[model samples]
Target: MKNLFLCSSFFDVAGILPNFLERINSNCIQTVSFIDIASHVEEYKEYVEKAKLAFEQQSLKLEVIDFNQSSDDIVQQLQKNDLIYISGGNTFYLLQMLNEKKLTNVIVDLINYGKPYIGESAGSVLLSENIEYIKKMDNPQNAPNLKNYKSLNIIDFYPVPHFENQPFKNLVEQVISEYGESLPLIAFDNKQALWVLDKTIILKDET
Candidate 1:
């Protein structure tokens, strides 16, 4: 059976990450430590602590794995989780490392086994087939290196996060002209998101 998939522009502000965790029974969340890949060892402890505190504010418990120590160590560390939350960061680098460590299969298993998965920004982008279509405002080279690289493929369409933040009207049109309109483009503003649950997409607006 396929698990539920959740994609958000920004966890709490744009999506219901915090709220969703709070609403679940026990008011606690089961999260993996994928973002630790972006930090140094010295900073990871504090980072995880702060993340726990932030989630706990909304009654969630953020569990992290020191994937830096060994990316192969993620599977065991993730054994008890029911909900995996992927935080925001550099998508290209993250996917590169994940592939290097061969943790992508483990992540796919988590999703296929009825575990509810949540992703934000970079994390959300990895759920799609391609991240090359997104325009980088700061770095022109922010695009992922693998054009045919694999993603979790949890979402049916391609995603363009931070959509309304830029002049997407023209940029989107350009992409459509090149890639064809048959390609799905799900756009989200900083305060808006498109959520996927059981293969159904829902539009969520911030209050």
Candidate 2:
């Protein structure tokens, strides 16, 4: 049961599920979207509902799980899930919550178990070994940092999501400069994608 790490700025693609769904056991192909841990519990509920609507519109079968739940509780929910989607939000906050909940290890096990994964925005970026390339809120914005926020290491290098979108290009350049030329950094514009196969990665249009 090999896994494919499908990366996207968003998962609005209608056929996205079927493409990989057919490859894995139906029961194993589950979808979980990670929301911004920075938001209040009430606000996060709204976010999850909207996400559910989007997936429903596509007629995709996704069992949404709120990672903000108690750390011990998350493992039970994740035991059988296949695809865990991480939505865009504060990258550092997301990692902080993940570490606090101890859900990262469960995620690693799920991926190793051949459960496919998809991420958008913060979700996509958090999988990299380091998300230092991402820009945080400055004087105008309030962002939280939980110690040294490192990513899940699901991918070998850093990921630059939302390229061609505001402020992203600037940070990407900085990341490249800091990491040097040999790093396997991936940068994609909105409506573009990085598709994962057993042992290969392909870029495709959002449609």
Candidate 3:
């Protein structure tokens, strides 16, 4: 019952998701909690707008829960949502917040219970065993004192998001040289998605 649709860019990929809707129980994703950590550096209006449009286009009712409040408050709110979507952003900061809030275990519990979860960009990177891949794409100084750098370990391969784009693309070689030897790395852009259902893994992208 493990279902995941780790996407690169929700709006950027556009019509691609409708194809995978059937796998998500056809429940219309009624309530949602969007972890908006990635867009922390910018206004959230755009991300929310795009997400709203995407849900509407799919004929799904989405009630986005605000997660910027206290960890206790967030956790309480989380119980109301049927879906959890982590948006792309500063991975280090995102993980830092999750740990600092002590909300990591709750998320682990939720996902382990077979709740559908979606991750994009930095969100996708956190699904690996470790966030060492963030060394190349994001700055750890935001959470430099972070002691536990371990990721969710839900997936085995490291998803090097933003394969051919700026900033992130520049560090691909370095990330590969450092971790690619032991850890498997799969590079993807805004147009791709990694679909996971228990033991089966599929890459949804343009061939």
Candidate 4:
């Protein structure tokens, strides 16, 4: 069964993550393979630390992987982890690195094989059928090597993260305005997340 926890801002919802995992009977997670390739830039780098702190608070070990660096053992690293996390950053750049490293299929296969997956912000957006609609919120120029906007296509609907939240509020609105009629866009705020189990998708909030 496919399991996914897609979030707008993981830091905002970290406190309740364990509860959700417990509900899904996945609270035994001891280690996580954190894909930090998205937040590769200097400014976005801070998010990686925050993510590590979140996992540390849960007493879970983390093995962070950055595709920009030597990731020859990416498959082995991912297979050893109990959970997989993709951090938020430049969506285009993140996708570019995933494609460049040719780990997209590997990730998809792992998720399909029941490895729990968590995506925050750009990470959440990357699961959609196509990331072309996100150009309004994230700069496409950041991914100079990206040949296409095609994405993991893990989920059929488009996940609009940071909805009604600062900085990205207007950008998210723009995307919804442009693609709302055509694409199946699910917009959620920093306090909300999409819990996907196989074909069933549920939107949950802190409340």
lDDT of 1 by residue, 1-207 (tens): 443333433434523555544433324444444354522312223433444555566554566665656754677666576567666555666666677677778887777765666665556777877655543421224334534446767777776556545443565456546555666877666566565655567677778
Candidate 3 has its poorest 10 consecutive residues by lDDT at 39-48
Report the number of backbone clashes for model 4: 0
CA lDDT, candidate 4, residue 5: 93
By lDDT: ranked, best first: 4, 3, 2, 1
Give per-residue CA lDDT, model 4, range 1-207, as digits (tens).
788999988877887788768867997899999988887753747767888998899899999785646556887888889999999988999999988888889889999988899999999999998999999988999899898999999999999999999988899899999999999999999999889989999888876
Estimated TM-score for each candidate:
0.72, 0.76, 0.86, 0.95
Question: Between which residue pairs do clashes occur in model 2?
Answer: 30-83, 32-85
Whole-model lDDT for model 3 versus the true structure? 0.74
Off by over 4 Å in 1: 1-11, 18-53, 135-148, 166-182
| Highest-scoring model, lDDT | 4
Query: What lDDT does the true structure give each of the candidates?
Result: 0.57, 0.60, 0.74, 0.88
Measured over all alpha carbons after superposition, the RMSD of each candidate to the real structure, in angstroms, is 4.9, 4.0, 2.5, 1.4
Worst 10 residues of 4 by lDDT: 64-73
Residue-level lDDT of model 3, residues 55-140, one tens digit each, is 67866556554545687888876776777788877788888878878877888778778877888777788888889766877778
The Cα error of candidate 2 at residue 138, in Å, is: 9.1
Q: How accurate is candidate 4 locally (lDDT)?
A: 0.88
In candidate 4, list every pair of residues with a backbone clash: none
Report, for all candidates in order, the number of backbone clashes: 0, 2, 1, 0
